[model samples]
Target: MRKTLEEKLVPPVPPAVRRAMLDAREALPPGGADVTARLFAAMKENRDAPTLPSSKSFRDAAASESTFRTLLRCLARYAPHICTSNAVTVSEEWYARRPKHVTMGKSTPVQPTIWPAAWRALAPALDAAPIKQSSKRRYRASIDRCAAMVRAGRASSDFGFVAAADLADAFLFNADATARVKPITAAGYLDGLIALGRFGGIDRVHLLPMQLVAEDLREQAAMMPKNKEARIGAFMERGGFGYAADRIAVCLRRAESLPVHSAAGRRALQTAMVCAVFMNKPARKGDMVSWRIGHDIVRQPNGEWSLAWQQGKTGKNTEAGVLWPEVCYILDLWILGGRPDRLVYHRYHELEGLFLLSQSECQAYRNLPSELTLSAIGVPSHDLRTAAADYMRHYDPEHAANVISAHLGHGSQKSGEAYRSECSAAAGQSEWQRSRMIWS
Candidate 1:
């Protein structure tokens, strides 16, 4: 076989080059490790070649555009190690250092007398539109993005207030402004345009761009099911969290056994305990952080601990009335000074939050740790909810869906059905294992 151009021209790299490559990778996101390794391997073999590819060529050749962006971010942090005077000119860091093209001005009610009637009418309609705060904020951001495009000479003047071909041209196809954005972000821009058109009373047919973008995204996303269980399992597997409940139990047990004598150790234990309860209750970040001590945590007449908190996502009042004894014990240790007396403080007493940091000085802060790492296994706090559903389905397949829906504060059975669908494959595996064990 003929040697390739790269193979013929480049000799094998040395230990120093490999060390530099590995050192550069520490700055990247977790997913970038493999890409960084491959890039470095090629660079190592060709010592005379540039340490990193030109930004455009690297981005164009990347299998995942997202990874390319991450590579750029990491390069910005460790550019000295990865690039030299002859390396990529159009790196993300260079662009970042340039003056920001986007700007926001104070918004005022559109003066009906000074503006076109269609554009002026939009102001009142937008104010009257019934939408959530988050949606409203997104709409405002979309308007701002459109305005920036116009100021940057990428779009026509009539972009946001009144819809036209120019708006879609700038938002969807204007390469100068949105060339780097992901399809999902483009879809969001389309949504913002549709909302603007709706409020402006533009013809429905004129909103074809937004519809087309949505259809395109839907077609792409259809390649994989949006089942929460599959997503949770994939997230865990990527982080070395085993696919079974027993594996997760072992990881949690190891986490819980960490010493609590020091402040940092106590904090780790606190995060672990919170994570265990989060999995047990299948709670969302909002639910975990919103808990108030006296209101959410109550001792029942039977002496068992219970939790009652409103789930903001579904707007439903929820209760995890039957807590496991282990969960209760962990909560007791956390609340009653898990750390040494000399290191403990009492300022947390004044805070209204249930999930405070374990450090005495930082206990007044109100956010729960959103992620936990147990040895090599990492679990996101939000995914714990899905893991809980999966666990229940494996152990109690018949009533798992309905039971988990109620436990997780879902408003409808359809929500539960999504979880059940995701858990089906895992549940089947569990069933087969049980049957095999019984026969053996």
Candidate 2:
């Protein structure tokens, strides 16, 4: 009744490759694709069964049973007929729209404007970043609606794109209002405040701190149990202030010279740094944090590495595990600060977000565009992992999937596919965009 993938077919491993894998594991790293390849090869030649991640890691990667089903699809692609699946009808499928509208249509060849898309990118910063209690369901509804619209031909590639050749208006978003273009009234600000108190985190729509909600948030935070710091961090991040947590993580990483003498900075720094450590482990931030374990990281007889807490923002479910070097560096930094057991990345997340906010505060004093300042890096904390994926792909096309999957702690490979975020990195982005306009 139960057919194990490992029991089926195996890939042949040469002695030379085995030696290479052992050498690399001892010297270079453990999760290197070469090691994985060698292990697969050995399984074929010697009929040696494969290793698995600790159950804790696997559970972390698979937040729910449905998520595990998705993992089966990824496995089938990577290793054909390796895993089994229970097929469900297409009528059972559903969709969910994300944070905002995504327009995918035929390209009419709009030229890139002289204005940097950087400011538009930065528009998400400030008091505007907010997600509501009702928002997620609304978004999910939107996706379902979008799917139906597509199927009915109400919206399709034929619907076409905006005709503007330039994006002088893209930066023109309603910051003081809902993303729906409504003016941000007192009620809107209040709605944002309630959401923040309910969901605080970097990804939260309510990114900025509110003078009115300050006391309320503090009271709410104080009542949360000490062990539930993960939830607290999520609340902050979900409110669009997760970056603040990241800054705190950065501070913890380099806590040696941080000016503790500055009262506000020290307090904010300490709070953010501590949160990053707790929040770094997998969990969604809202009223509370919930942790899950997956099969991949389970300590089964076949599992290889020991299970440890993950540092992915989307929790273990969507994001893959951190790279060994990156994880080690984070741990070493934590040890240096005499806070080895403390949650490191959550602190970094807090520190990073606070630092950005402080920088924006300084910018506000000068009346400069803080949005432009934030987008200078062109990406966020998580993009570094995707950047790493792109870097790996740049180095090798074939082995990119395995290394990226292990690195990001994902149960599957879709995130790696979504790594094509950068315009230049996308397959067809250059087809229409020209570096030179032939001015001569």
Candidate 3:
């Protein structure tokens, strides 16, 4: 008789060993549960295995190279006694032997550009242009898309040459069908084409039409409502800044009581710290990730915490005054308690001074706040900065301009105009409501 799938999955280990594996599984983050279970099952099946299964055996069972590495880390943390001294070394060697630059899963074949001759003709001019390398890369990508469109018979072709019409047609392809061209994307595409024309030494008289189209696109983009405005308004309407603050406070409280070694607890503490810093300082994402303990974030003699960093965008030295006490408390808990416990086993020394240790952790720090709030607030992390500015404008209208400029590291007071306008609109709406109530 054939065994059931559930029966096959169950590890045929002794009761004591099974219980130990279950306990170790609980310490793992939610995503690690399945992989950890599989590891234990493999261990139970191999009677010759004293500790972990061989690297080759485990690699066969793993979904991907990334997953195999993740499982190894989990074992090192939760069941370190079972992991051999050379476990990580063996896994690293196995990873190194795998094919380079080759994606694991089924991948779409690369499509050759239709106008190779045109691209070859344009490549030299683009490379030699005295523009930023980033700009050159953007132009090359835009030209590639134009060539693809022409190949697909979706855009005009001028005797196998890519022209302005083809560039415009490529912009409208919507090839992915996921979203239409956003105003900002349209602007980027137009800019790339303009730069390409100049680099190709096309006559200004012939380029006048493309330049005019670029200006029109910029006008349309300016007229469109700002995403920050919409996000701020939605977040404010749904209990505003107070709601996000309350959520962070709840996470911190829960995290404080849980064991530092618990992955879920460490995650909760990290999320609270991320949201709190953004709420108080409103720094850009790059600065937040790059922040170091003794350098960018510091504690003063008065026992208050302050943050100062050279702004990545503007290259200006910006600093924020003492953070809120709640923010400071969460930071202390994470730095002193949760962080060290989490990183002790792996890559701790390499990532000692950084605020966020890994890309996955950084993404979670940026994303989890919004998830916890049910997407009603703090989406994209930057929205927290906008909310902070909006709250000041609404409550402390007199100091809103200067305060926002300083608090958000904005280069000029004019940047606070949108927040001020939002406050005025809300105030006018309130007055209209009160007038109706009196008349009624």
Candidate 4:
């Protein structure tokens, strides 16, 4: 007469635990209580007794699930035995005093880290800067790496005065037992250290020279020549790009032909629309994934669609682009019939993201690279972005750098150079074609 899994899982919350949960609800911001209650109810379904998350566990989870962090913090203070993280102790002080220095977010209350006195000196400025929590973690990690270098006798003790040559030696040669650090990582470490110094009232004249070295290293890694010519040649030899647009059109047609009830078929249409938009807009993946239906995109009364773009990486918040009518039609089909998820954060917030993938569906695409593979027609996503930029400059000789910059939503003309460089090989082909026509 053993109980079934569902029966075994339906244990009631203990009296003490319920009291703690009530306290957590009270601590939460308006509307956060609902999120906490839902989270608690979900946790109660587990067979095991409630326990605190580990320090590392809480740190990692806090980044994605801020509500979980909030509840955990409150529970930690109320019932210490259930929680083990040092954060629990910190939370007690935080909730009681409500320090003026502490910053608050929608879900989780920020707690001050116990850094070394020397490092703590830098916290005020760092905290004041308008950066995300994930970024703060990265900056702290970089600082720790640099400090490790110093402790290992590889660099100057003074983080401010650490020389470029020392950084190169430590980063490039693996002065420690670990493998040589990648150039990109080395560059990030350098940038983080410089930023820390800058915000701490360090002089620019001192930081700039070291920063320049890091910049050069980063550019060297990024601008390293890739044999795209060889890859393209091999691809063409295999009959690729023989009317690529026609292939795209056929893919779109196949998507349209799919049965209305098919989720997989609708996903295919979503992919097609993503490709179409990128082909014309030169949008980065971040931009495409985070787009909303109403806020980012709008349909005008005159039957035209406009996209309001904000390139997060470049800090360019204002840019306008056109959305072709055909693209808009596909978008409408996906929005109306695709069964979008109702994300409940701000109740008034509309348009539950432009491209809504289910949790399971997202997991399926987790391993897939950012490349289009519609019925065996595979193409790297960046290729379309590069092609658009190339067509702008190489095919249209009158196109200027500024024009290309505007099209790509780039903050500077310098950013458009990579696309132009890719088109250099095509220049000869274009000239040869012109000469053949003249000879005829």
- Give the per-residue lDDT of model 4 (tens digit) for 171-195: 8888455757767878888777777
Per-residue C-alpha lDDT of model 2 across residues 376-427, encoded as one tens digit per residue: 2222234334444555655554455665566556655555455433422543
**Cand. 2 Cα-lDDT:** 0.33
Identify the runs in model 4 with alpha carbons over 4 angstroms from their true place.
1-120, 130-157, 160-185, 203-209, 227-270, 299-305, 315-322, 337-380, 400-402, 417-440
- What TM value does model 3 have? 0.58
**What is the full ranking by lDDT, best candidate first?**
3, 4, 1, 2
After superposing candidate 1 on the true structure, give the runs of residues whose Cα lies further than 4 Å from its correct spot.
1-128, 138-186, 196-203, 224-270, 298-305, 336-349, 352-377, 420-440
**Which pairs of residues have clashing backbones in candidate 1?**
none
After best superposition, candidate 4 residue 87: deviation in angstroms?
38
Question: Which pairs clash in the backbone of model 3?
Answer: none
Task: Please report the candidate that would top lDDT against the real structure.
Answer: 3
Cα error, residue 318 of model 1, in Å, equals: 2.2
Candidate 2 Cα deviation (angstroms), residue 288: 13
Q: Which ten residues in a row have the lowest lDDT in candidate 1?
A: 339-348
For candidate 3, give the lDDT of residue 272. Answer: 78
lDDT at residue 145 of model 1 (Cα atoms): 65
Question: How do the residues 68-134 of candidate 1 rate in per-residue lDDT, one tens digit apiece?
Answer: 5565554444443443212222333344555554457544454322333444457667767887655
Clashes of 2: 81
